[model samples]
Target: MASVAEAYVFLTYLKVLFLTVTTYLTCTAHNSPTRPMFSVFTSYNDSLEKTHGLPTNLSWSQLASTVGEDKTSSSCQPVGIYSIQRHGSRYPEQRIITTYQTFFSRIARSRINEEFAYLKNEPLDRFTVEKAECLTDKGYNELLEISARYPARLFPLFRDPVSIFTQSSFQSTETNRTKESAEAFISGLCKECRFITPKHDEDKLILVMKDGKIYSEIHWLPILHDPLLLPKISSGICKDSIAIEEHSREFYSFKNSPFVEEVLHHVISRLDYTGDFSMTLDELQSLYEICATEMNLFGASNWCKLFSQSDLRAMEYLYDLQEYWYSSYGYRINYLPYCVLLQDIASHLESSVASGSTSTKKIFKFAHSTTIQGLFALLGLYRTSVIPTADNYPLDGNWEYRGGIISPYAANIVFSVFRCAGRSTLPNAIGDVKVLITHNEQPLKIGPCDSYYCDLTTLTSYLRSKVGSCDLDEICGGVVRDLPMKT
Candidate 1:
């Protein structure tokens, strides 16, 4: 948005409180002595079983049994939700199914009718990256079949109208990549889903460009700019080498070195600049400063939102993530400004429901695993290293890139939904999140894989015991875990 001073004082209070809370909680979390962590102790009249944290699994009948226990009819509904899933598989080839002269050409004609955006000064050309944004036919069909298979997955919560969703995508929001995926998903419930991709491919998952009619270029970098409350570093890679293929392996080694930490810092300094700036040789330094400033505070998206044409930056999101992760509450790397917004969203949803709104109205955020990992790292959810990175990165690669035999691009992400108080325990409105690993609805991995109905009760029992006096809104409060910024 050009300007948003609406919450000037509130924003100021939020910023200071956030910084102070983060600093204080983080320090306490880190320094606080560790307690032998334990799950809630729930007893099923006959047997006793113990379980770990969320992304855990349970059986169906067990849940039915739990409902029977709560004959008193508690205000909070007892329910569980899951990660919509498919199976684990390789990313198939696209050339065999579709071909194009250059990836850049594909960006110009993205599925999300960007014509309107182009006319608004946020020209399509400006959005254009050096590459394309479609998925391969195989990739396209994969998501389609997934949609058809799990047509009933979300039907319980959103029968007809659903507001927002968070999905994971890789290798360019390629027509085939994002479009095909969106189509396959929406077609399942006969809901008209829209893929509003722009001509810029750099912001996509994987981007390929032509290098002087010779070798094709591939860029794994993305541009995340948020103007206000930005970072001290930049996400987008340097542009002087768009013709990256021309550089030899030896040449790139020097360019890719992380020794140039200051170089990154320099690019982040200009986020939220009020001055009217234009591209020019001298302005390179200014632009670099903007990027560096933003990166230091937020990531590229924060920079983009402030400077980019969007009226809103990252969509307001909600996360039911735990607070005081384990014990202390030190600010974790996941304490990025983006997450603050998520907490805000969750708070909003909770408030909305306290009054009156469609109970089933739910929103999902398709964000990077790093977003979660960062928080996990901050909160000590899991080992910080679980984020999947080698410490050093290849030149022009995804910052959150994690590779392996599985190619590390399975759209690994955290899928969470919001449930109104009335339906918290409802089968469809279960507020729990499911952890899955698959390209389609087929689950390559499913939590509660072993725990049956009895196990689920144990989980609730565990929550009641271990979970502090915090309410749902407090749970969403940035209290779960606090670690230093890994970023």
Candidate 2:
């Protein structure tokens, strides 16, 4: 046998030779006339502008269109606004980071193919997975911009600077991200304003359940049951296991398709390496997640270049399906907590109307996307007529209606209540007050309401009718005898 140093030098030479040959083959194959050049680099910047699940960057014009032009409504004066907002972009969860690191380490140790040899030697310093659940700088800035722009957009409605009260979901252990988002929003609204971090006792605006105990800070007791309510009458409804399995199978089929595999192989083959190449489907998915999450956090990622727009759409659909089945309208229990939250909103609105305080003009809530999605589903916003199944995701389907679009980072829903001077057009008028609802800064019409503004009496009555007494204990804990799989 040769001495250790000689053996090391020989092995290094062999590795270099293998990489050179592999790189040459990859380049040749990619340059073939029959093969279309697939590169994300050319479109990466454009693609970032249209990423589905993360918050889409909006221009002032787009924001203006969403809130509508300040068409002078002589009869109505904005008295108060209630806004529910999702937290800004954040670092991947610890679990996601751990999975990504494991995949990267495996790639580093394995034999890399010619098409993916670049990955073997790629520096991971920029992609270092953060272990904490904190908001990225991008996330912070998104919130900052939103806060600064909102006052300007609503200027016509509320001419004077209004006092804002910011609140967030209360946890036994503090959620720093939610708090930080709330702080950023307050800072943007007015620099001198202080953020109110409500504890369980002071959080009367939103209901909180901890260890089977429900707490509410509000004193007004509205009727608890509303006919138009979103939560199931019974808790017997669970996710359809058959449907979930079918979805899984469909996802697997897509992931294992020749097109996807070719893309994966191309990515892996470019990684410079000396060993035999091998990668599992899970590892491939982890790589995609890294691309997606990194892009959302940092505005760009090289991993994004590994796939085309079609590939991104497929991945987006998969994530949408997951949220639909597990979080939004999927299971009966999935939206119960949000029901309580809705009740809280209604209670606060009613209280504001009763108190008639211009000093407390805005109610701002900061929460996770889970809260936003749950509330959206409960309100039937952007719901598909036919529930999406894993096997039947149509490429031509309405992408705008997807949950990814509805509850992206910094996603928000706003209800602006106005005190009007005219007689109500709506049935059972309670004075001349009206309410306008907006989602992601855009006005959203309630079912058959037709106009951007719904009569305050009509809106509150509808909400109260659906919400009834707004009792959390009864609604959350009540047992419905027989809940069907689908409403």
Candidate 3:
């Protein structure tokens, strides 16, 4: 009923307000490309409605043609390769909590809660969140669907009716996540999946040598429980948590402890080994001899001065101390106990795989975002030293609030699909196993691997800069791989 002049004036004022406020704020973080991510209802576009275009492959008939892959008109042949991949995007539902504890422990507890929220909503997904690694409920469904959609890309072991397959879980010996992820995966697999627990003491594959041996490995797994125990850090710690919890003890000490690695790090840090040069055995030993007295006199606080005197690799020593010093000392100071029985569970898994048939058994490891990034040297993913514990809750529900095109935290599921490839070596033909990442994201404003999922467009942009072009397929590395090529 309004006049045309009045309507134009009203629309003009609204447009002015939108441009000056909401639109500007919302669009600040977006990097819209020429094409939008998804398209809908394009069959009649070209003939009836002309402005927009459809994806090149869109057609009802072609879509139908591709539907029956798992249902072929032909007989199946044996192709028994197994490959591993992490789970797709998920988010640990974040929550605010309240508690008072040491920083690290507190962090662990809160992060568990965020993950707990995820499980609460998505209970059917397998994976328990207690320990260091495991999948979530959404991750459980996502992987099952991923395999179903891309069965051709999946290892042959996963698709076989006779094959025993399930995901590997990563649990830090905590509580909820481990049990939950395993349950989710088991429900989906509907087959008994073997569990591979990590060792209590894990050795880092720091370098692969010219002799083709995997060595120079510094361990990340040993300090907690039995000397040789390697708890499947993931494998979703069992529902019998109470059974192994006593074994899952952590140690602490205000006084200096006798862990030799702690002493060595202290002395080396004091001397400042940048890692440009190696230390002699006697020098290493003598330094350890002096470390106890020095640490006893000064707490973990001043232990670095010992390396202040070393000009050799001063920077490198500082770097090592920067990275490993706190952990080493924290381990010694805490005298934490590890879950030996839990570790046995991990070993049991390795043994199970060793004993299974090369052609028949398949192992799938489902674990956390950090477990994969930390181990793989993914220079891209972000991790924090602060573990989020239950105590981090703000008094108000409005803690750390943000809006207007905010990017969310994405959780990943990493799979290490293990297949028994040989008979004589205890299923030891290991080099053939593969790894891949699957994500449903574009680029992030913060950048690649910004969220748990690798931001493909950022990686693509980075690679394009290095290669002097933007064609993603032409080079070896982009921000993210477009499609995993089978080697």
Candidate 4:
């Protein structure tokens, strides 16, 4: 046997030789005339700009045409606005990080396409285990920009900054990303505000003070185990097994479909993969996910170069299918879990209208994508006439749901209450208090309403009718644990 140092040197030389040969093969194959003319037709930036997939970055101008110029009726003066926003763009979850490491390792061991040669020694400093699931710098700025836009886009909601600050309440799920997102948003909303961190880690409420006076309060609620946001997990209103079963059936069926398989085959051919490793459908899909998330984090991704517009759309559809089945409009029970939250909002709106004060002027909750999707389902905002399945691709007017537009990072639902000049006998109104709801800064008409603005009492009554009397124990068929009382 050779000496230890000699053996180490010999192994290192072999490794260098292997990498050199691999690089040469990759470059040669890419330049070969036999190689198909397959490259990104639309640039990744343009593709991402047009993408309506779940991972699209949030922008204030995203719906400028669709929303048009500020359409708040001149006769209507804003009183209060209640909003629920998904946390801004965040780093990939731990599982995604782990899978990315594995994928890069596999690529390093293989003779990859020249376009993807960077994967052989891809630096993962941006997506370390320590940063898993935390909001990135880009994510913080997304929320900051969104919060700054409310004054102009939503208009007059923050006209009285002092009153708004004193009365408004901010809440978030018990997650670092959510809390950080809320903080970033508040920074833009209230530039001169001060925060009082809780003395105990167990404390949920944080006091907000301005000029030595208490301005408002921030509440951090439990996540995953929360009663209002994730009742499926908290109260067992929806069975996890059912979702899992449906997801598995669709996941395999769709991935194994002829269309999807053909796309996968094309990708494999372009990759010209030469290694002991065989990529599974799941791993292939993960590549799309990495491309999307990296785009969100850095405004671009090298992995995105591996795909064409069609490929991204196909991959997007897979996730769209997952969101449809798991979160929105897949089953009736999915909506039931959100009743408690809707009912709470109904009470708050009704009370705010009754009080007619800025105390309840702005109520903001920072939550997750699932929370927004489930809430939309509860309100019947986006529904499709045709069911999405592996056999069908509802590409035209048939499909109304697009995950990117509906529940993208920093997705929000806003209910702006306006005091309209009119003559009405409705209780607690000299004329009429109108409620205008918007999804991601664009008008979203509520159920059975022809226009974006609906009567506050009418809207509150409708919400109550849907879920006002929901009994968690009875609805869930089990005793639901309640959130601890705030100290």
Candidate 5:
């Protein structure tokens, strides 16, 4: 019953008051010293549980809370979820293990140098390389935790008990880590369900080459004719000896730099390796790996103390360069493998829409970190324009935004479909289905779709175009013989 003029004035006052309060809260939150920031490594004095990278792998729950989206709106519901995840922490490779043990043995036997005086009486136990290529107990726990938490997050999407189909790409007797990771996740997710054994579907999941013999199975149509697959499309693909040697040279050349030399000297002195000994690039790499592996297994190690924060950051960048050029976004051809995966994702989404309620609710794939990295690059997520170089390593730059974070142990990329109840101008709206892509629990802002939640039809069209451009026969002709294959 109030007058129009009075009501307008009162509403304007309320709006102004609301804006003022919101602005104050936002400013307060931004300026608060207690606010948490993402850190790549914990302080030397901090407990190993606080470490965030390579060694002492981040727990899935901690990662999810730090980077994951907030609770979805009450109205928005998840219809389907597709996820591809990497296995968690594991023992180092045989060569790395040997190098670490040898290095430590030398240190233990070295006449107590002033620099390494602390280790004079410190009982240095020799490390043995056991259970190589197998998941550590911590790795198993990580997947288990993820399975428990992810379901609750997606509960609103499907009120019913959602069906899960798990797949893994580990085929070799030596590489059971992927399969174990998948089993652990399933155990956590469906406690009552039996563990499903993984099938070796090379034609669908992997590209293998042995002794110059290539077994090319074009799983995804988009990569069919892609020329990038021509260069050893198997485990050996990433092991390009020439490329690794070049990278090693670049890394070693930095030793001549005064700053690097000073840091190296300081690190060597602290580790008690001073006195007429110069560290080779190979030695430095081995030392870093030893630090990482020790921390990963035992939660703490003296090796962690040998390097400062700046040194760790530098080493991380070195690793970034290796991973990038070897099998990630930096390599142009790497996208071919993941483009196929994207097509599969598109197909699954299409089926979900076509079948409506009858479609599979969840699709889970377990693979190596390489798979996640390739997909991340193909999707152009967390990519930087400035390519890293040995001399121009951007220490002050956003290194945390690179593959180090994108492909951490147990890293995952998730695509979630939500049936939004709304109207849209696009054709085949089908109740305005939207898809959200998240890497490592954090939602990605896909540039192609230009939104966090992309319209299904638009996303589908883009993915189909990618798939349509492939001609597998042309790309894999040398190895694409008519073998009895299952698609």
Candidate 6:
């Protein structure tokens, strides 16, 4: 409670402070040679569309195509389709919801700037900590669309009057969002299919050896515990300690970097807290999470308006660094967990080739982002030579290992085996089997395949070579042995 004159003076000071920060941001962006250069700032709408590390639609960007698809003949028939999908977009975890509660409570009381005035009365109905991490309506709808698109994309490979009935397998993690996502995807794939309700007690799909006896067989639905997917988490290893150490090292490096410091300084100054207020790393992370989650929930977010595209990009880089070190290409041990999954894929394809009509046609696994990231690491999809370090704020060249592109909500990897009858580019010595791998429905030229259609032997050879004598028990400190797959 201040006098009118004093209030006027404070408002004037805030205006000038904002102007100063804006000018500084502009000058630094233009003058600094090391800073990441973007195209001229045209419109805020354009910036809104650029989801740096946020959840975006599956078709946000068209991945580069290296194979000559037009040159290849359509004589090949799709023998089997193996896919591993991340859960659809959902509410952030409880921690982030708690962040929303804390930050918004403060924001509700604070005098917000004109740009973000909406936050003063923003809807807090769904921001409670208890209500979090479930798939949204938009997420379910998007999964339906994704399922529709995949069938259309691979329609050429589908047997006439495409059907997944009786020949398909679906699996998901025990998590609610994953199970819901799987249901949504299957519904879209084939509306008439019936599934046994996923119950923890009876729907357990994984094979277990109880007193040296086989306890289960092939499951039509997802398993409750998939060691292949949740290797690091399920294994009784202190991998978290190692991840924490690496994350802290890189996080502090970026947190202390000049660009990040400057951005945060401006952010605090812009927030216009009455007294000497300092922003913590947790608060900064919370702001970004709010922006990202809100954007997915609603088409627009006021939280996003606070940062310039360059500022947001810098923030995005921080998260990219986090994901890169903790999940992908951080350490060899980090990706060894996925070796079992890779071997499973190889075995599935080989079995399909050996047993023609009796094999499963489609196999879908609904999992988490870590599963996708680990698989990417094992396959060497987007590994960059330039390690994402704190000092390298804006990675120089076209850096590909982005969290948004790689493991956004509903991120997926699909492998299709095509049996070619006529002349093909693949060597005849290894049979006429070709494999195509796609990430979010984009053809990927990675691993043993430089082209779109990789030979089965080449793909399997690379996987086997990479997984040579891999022992999960040894890696996870003899905690758990690799569960044998039922042949």
Winning candidate number (lDDT): 4
Write model 6 residue lDDT over 1-487, tens digit each, in one string: 4698899999999987875765344322322433322211111122223333222223212111223453442556566788998887777678877876787788777775555567778778766665587887767776676776655556543323235434667777877788778778866664433344333455544333333332222232333245677777665552432446644577678867777766676667666656565676677767767766665666456666565545666777777777777777766556777888888888777666663347676788888777888888878777786777777665333455577667777777888887777543443222477777777666677675767677777888887877766676676553322322110
Q: Candidate 1 vs candidate 4: which has greater lDDT?
A: 4
C-alpha lDDT of residue 426 in model 6: 41
The TM-scores, one per candidate, come to 0.32, 0.68, 0.28, 0.78, 0.68, 0.76
Model 5 scores a TM of: 0.68
Q: What is the C-alpha local distance difference test score of each model?
A: 0.27, 0.54, 0.27, 0.64, 0.54, 0.63
Clashing pairs in 4: 53-404
Backbone clashes under 3 angstroms, per model: 102, 27, 94, 1, 7, 1
lDDT of 5 at 338: 53
Measured with C-alpha atoms, the lDDT of residue 175 in candidate 6 is 77
The worst-scoring run of ten residues by lDDT in candidate 3 lies at 35-44
Q: Once superposed on the true structure, which residue ranges of model 6 sit more than 4 Å away at CA?
A: 1-67, 112-115, 156-162, 191-201, 204-225, 238-243, 273-278, 395-400, 422-431, 478-487
lDDT of 2 at 42: 13
lDDT tens per residue, model 5, 243-277: 44543454455544554565466566555533655
What TM-score does candidate 3 reach? 0.28
Tens digits of per-residue lDDT for model 4, 1-487: 4699899999999986863443333212322332211111112222234443323232222332334422534466666778898887777678777787787777777887776677666676767779887987867887887787676555555655565574677888888888888878876775556656633246354545645564455577555467776676776444432446654455467778875775576567567756433666766776766777765555466766656554555666767777777777775555667898898788677666663543466789888877888888877777777677777864321344567767777778888777767764356655567777877665667876656677777788778777845776555443322321110
Segments of candidate 5 deviating more than 4 angstroms: 1-74, 113-127, 156-174, 192-232, 235-263, 272-274, 297-299, 356-359, 395-401, 422-430, 465-468, 472-487
For 33-98, candidate 2 gives per-residue lDDT tens digits of 322111111122222233422233443234334445334244565666778777776666666666
| Deviation of model 6 at 87, angstroms | 0.9
The C-alpha RMSD of each candidate to the native structure, in angstroms, is 23.0, 11.7, 23.9, 11.9, 16.1, 9.8
Model 3 accuracy (lDDT, Cα)? 0.27
lDDT of each residue in 74-135, candidate 1, tens digit only: 22232213232211122223331122222223333333223222412322332222323333
How would you encode candidate 3's per-residue C-alpha lDDT over 40-72 as one tens digit per residue?
Answer: 101111111122222323221222233332222
